[model samples]
Target: MRDFTWHVFTQTGDIEAYLLYKEMHNLGAPELGANAGAEDDEGNVADEE
Candidate 1:
Protein backbone atom coordinates (compact mmCIF):
# COMPACT_ATOMS: atom_id res chain seq x y z
CA MET A 1 0.00 0.00 0.00
CA ARG A 2 2.81 2.39 0.84
CA ASP A 3 4.64 1.50 -2.34
CA PHE A 4 1.50 2.02 -4.41
CA THR A 5 0.92 5.38 -2.77
CA TRP A 6 4.50 6.40 -3.39
CA HIS A 7 4.33 5.34 -7.02
CA VAL A 8 1.14 7.31 -7.50
CA PHE A 9 2.71 10.32 -5.86
CA THR A 10 5.82 10.11 -8.02
CA GLN A 11 4.00 9.55 -11.27
CA THR A 12 1.24 12.07 -10.75
CA GLY A 13 2.91 14.48 -8.34
CA ASP A 14 -0.16 14.21 -6.14
CA ILE A 15 0.34 15.89 -2.80
CA GLU A 16 -2.40 13.78 -1.25
CA ALA A 17 -0.77 10.53 -2.35
CA TYR A 18 2.59 11.75 -1.11
CA LEU A 19 1.09 12.62 2.24
CA LEU A 20 -0.59 9.20 2.40
CA TYR A 21 2.71 7.49 1.63
CA LYS A 22 4.44 9.49 4.32
CA GLU A 23 1.74 8.63 6.83
CA MET A 24 1.90 4.91 6.02
CA HIS A 25 5.69 5.05 6.16
CA ASN A 26 5.63 6.64 9.58
CA LEU A 27 3.06 4.17 10.87
CA GLY A 28 5.19 1.18 9.84
CA ALA A 29 8.54 2.52 11.00
CA PRO A 30 10.79 0.37 13.19
CA GLU A 31 11.08 3.07 15.84
CA LEU A 32 7.63 2.20 17.08
CA GLY A 33 8.69 -1.39 17.75
CA ALA A 34 11.06 -0.25 20.50
CA ASN A 35 8.20 1.43 22.31
CA ALA A 36 5.48 -1.09 21.52
CA GLY A 37 5.48 -2.54 24.99
CA ALA A 38 5.90 0.83 26.69
CA GLU A 39 2.51 2.10 25.63
CA ASP A 40 -0.73 1.09 27.21
CA ASP A 41 -3.96 0.37 25.36
CA GLU A 42 -4.83 4.03 25.32
CA GLY A 43 -1.39 4.81 23.92
CA ASN A 44 -0.04 6.44 27.05
CA VAL A 45 3.52 5.42 27.79
CA ALA A 46 4.00 3.50 31.02
CA ASP A 47 6.85 5.01 32.94
CA GLU A 48 8.71 2.90 35.44
CA GLU A 49 10.24 4.71 38.30
Candidate 2:
Protein backbone atom coordinates (compact mmCIF):
# COMPACT_ATOMS: atom_id res chain seq x y z
CA MET A 1 0.00 0.00 0.00
CA ARG A 2 2.78 2.41 0.82
CA ASP A 3 4.58 1.56 -2.38
CA PHE A 4 1.45 2.00 -4.43
CA THR A 5 0.62 5.35 -2.90
CA TRP A 6 4.16 6.53 -3.46
CA HIS A 7 4.05 5.35 -7.04
CA VAL A 8 0.82 7.25 -7.53
CA PHE A 9 2.34 10.32 -6.05
CA THR A 10 5.35 10.00 -8.32
CA GLN A 11 3.29 9.40 -11.40
CA THR A 12 0.65 12.05 -10.74
CA GLY A 13 2.44 14.45 -8.42
CA ASP A 14 -0.53 14.33 -6.06
CA ILE A 15 0.97 14.78 -2.64
CA GLU A 16 -2.40 15.38 -0.98
CA ALA A 17 -3.72 11.97 -1.98
CA TYR A 18 -0.49 10.29 -0.98
CA LEU A 19 -0.64 11.90 2.45
CA LEU A 20 -4.29 10.95 2.82
CA TYR A 21 -3.44 7.33 2.11
CA LYS A 22 -0.65 7.40 4.64
CA GLU A 23 -2.97 8.92 7.24
CA MET A 24 -5.57 6.23 6.54
CA HIS A 25 -2.98 3.56 7.26
CA ASN A 26 -1.32 5.28 10.20
CA LEU A 27 1.96 5.42 8.31
CA GLY A 28 4.91 7.41 9.53
CA ALA A 29 6.30 10.26 7.50
CA PRO A 30 9.10 8.42 5.75
CA GLU A 31 9.41 11.12 3.16
CA LEU A 32 10.22 13.59 5.90
CA GLY A 33 13.44 11.70 6.51
CA ALA A 34 14.74 12.86 3.18
CA ASN A 35 16.03 15.82 5.15
CA ALA A 36 17.63 13.56 7.79
CA GLY A 37 15.42 14.65 10.69
CA ALA A 38 12.42 12.28 10.75
CA GLU A 39 12.08 9.13 12.83
CA ASP A 40 10.73 5.74 11.94
CA ASP A 41 7.47 4.23 13.15
CA GLU A 42 9.25 2.52 16.07
CA GLY A 43 10.75 5.86 17.13
CA ASN A 44 14.27 4.88 16.12
CA VAL A 45 16.43 7.68 14.86
CA ALA A 46 17.38 7.44 11.22
CA ASP A 47 20.95 7.99 10.12
CA GLU A 48 21.76 11.65 9.72
CA GLU A 49 24.07 13.15 7.15
Model 1 / residue 26 / CA error / Å: 0.8
Model 1 TM-score, all chains together: 0.55
Query: Per-candidate TM vs. native?
Result: 0.55, 0.38
Lowest lDDT 10-mer window, candidate 2? Answer: 32-41
lDDT of each: 0.70, 0.62
Cα lDDT of candidate 1 equals 0.70
**Deviation from native of the Cα of residue 7 in model 2, angstroms:** 0.0
Leading candidate by TM-score: 1
List where candidate 1 sits over 4 angstroms from the true fold: 29-49
lDDT of 2 by residue, 1-49 (tens): 4555677888899988688767956856444334333335335534341
Question: How many pairs of residues in model 1 come into backbone collision?
Answer: 0
Q: Write the per-residue lDDT of candidate 1 for residues 1-49, one digit (tens) a residue.
A: 6666777999999999989888988888332333345345445433432
